[model samples]
Target: MLFGASDSYSADEKMQITVAFTRFGKNLVQRMPRVRFGFVHVVNNDYRHWIMSAIGGSSHPTIISHGNRFRAPRNIAAKEVCKREYATEQEWKNWDWRSEGDLMLNGAIFTQSGDPKAAKKFGGYRMIAYKPAHMVPLLVRWSGTLECRPNKPC
Candidate 1:
């Protein structure tokens, strides 16, 4: 909920987007839920990120952002912990997304953003090290480069 930029999106706005995206994410999980996802670093070109959210004792869905890359472990699975894109929105109430693929996730490596005394939080996670298990960049700077676009065809 702490915004560093004036024109930057707010927590409430982000939450509304989350609510709508959750449906698509929930549906994605219901269709194919429960998988180990990998993590990565955020660069300028990488687009899209997902979280294998630990909610309701099951892996729920939470949209991360576009243009971020996660580092994957060698033995990761692709068909689990991904998202689906709904409709694109221009208002503060609409959330749109589509599935990139299953994330080979490792949630233990990333720290949650709400921890006390942290100066900055990105994409619901905090930055504790230079090489994080997951990476969340501020913005997307490339197109047609699916470096971190949720799902990679393998």
Candidate 2:
């Protein structure tokens, strides 16, 4: 579940996305929703399972992650929750990717970079009222229209 452009990265695209009160898990190939060439606000989501990083992006996308839960997989090497594509550490270290009020579990780590005031710059209006990261499970308990019975047949 990726958002925005794939390779053609540019701020001129003016693409922006806000994901709130959702659940992200069971993804192995990529992040929950990697964005590119825009601003993305990922707030108040449950992340219980993921082989790769929970949130990832590239091409200088401004990622503002707040009040989300990230539970890393058993693999110790895959505990980091932020990944940059097609950029080296020196180049990606300047990207605006900030994580605030997020709950990390099972050695989950978020490599935040760029300016700390970036969130306040992009987050202008308060459209939705979301709970803290600890309450993500309760907020996103029942998503979709189907009965999601874990460890059992749906």
Candidate 3:
């Protein structure tokens, strides 16, 4: 349920938003049939990649089958939207997640190895984002949730 006025974003920005929503919708309708209804709120221009990834990879049958549920962006192409560089020395690793800005679009759903045949038409996806103000702290919480998910073999 992405929200925002056309005036808030440039024309180019809308393209990405459209793509994300479409892909998510397509995936849910086709793959997850359990969804009864969903909602979204696009607070601002801010984007959250980790949250989107979690929604995409969710193994829960309810999430997979539900036809209507607002998840993260789908076909988003990652860009160094925000970057901070280190100066002078060898630069150990000047990375800042707080300042790192990226967009995670609901891209075309595909089967692992980048195969078009595996692409699924979920339809235009939607987003409900919090402003950068809200996102900053939310990311920290999101990270914690992801850590417990267990991505490796237990």
Candidate 4:
């Protein structure tokens, strides 16, 4: 989960938080290769709004779906799924992940692509096509949990 205040963050802070999250994601993926779906908790309204805005305004196509058991922002869930035809250096400049928004290590789920049905089972879950990248930065001033689940039938 991601936690932060409703207040705005400077660009530098955002960058730092992104780096931290990237590191955390990398470690988590290394330790748990089976991870396919992940959850981010936002505790602050301002930060939450920012995240929602960013995701909503993202250049990528995002799908707004219904929320199930998970407590998603605004009682709704969002996801962006796309295929990665080629790898770009700009996408992996600060990390080994495939894209800037990708949080997965190898850009594949369970060492390969994931099933869309499996991803849809989770509320607010993302089974992105390009591996999870360019996630909104988790503010250092906030607190939250990053929960991950294996690529199993949910």
Best by TM-score: 2
**lDDT (Cα, tens digit) per residue for candidate 1, span 1-154:** 1111222223323321221112122222222222112112122222122334221111112323232233322223332233222312232112121222222333312222212322223434432122221332322222223455456662
lDDT of 3 by residue, 36-144 (tens): 1122221222233322222221111111111212334444542222211222223212211111122333442211211222112222353332234334334333322
- Supply candidate 4's per-residue lDDT for 85: 20
Query: Candidate 4 has what TM-score?
Result: 0.20
Which numbered prediction scores highest in lDDT against the true structure?
Answer: 2
Distance (Å) between predicted and true CA of 129, model 3? 7.6
TM-score of each: 0.20, 0.86, 0.17, 0.20
With candidate 2 superimposed using the best TM-score fit, by how many Å does residue 19's alpha carbon deviate from the native? 1.2
Runs in model 4 deviating more than 4 A are 1-29, 32-110, 124-135, 139-154
> lDDT of all the models against the reference?
0.25, 0.80, 0.24, 0.22
lDDT digits (tens) for residues 1-154 of candidate 4: 2222222332222211111222122111111111112222111111221112122111111122111011122312221212222234343122111212223221222111223343344334333222122333433324345565698543
Kindly provide the TM-score of model 1 when superposed on the true structure, using C-alpha atoms.
0.20
Model 4: per-residue Cα lDDT at residue 7: 20
Model 2 alpha-carbon drift over 4 Å, by segment: 9-12, 126-129, 145-154
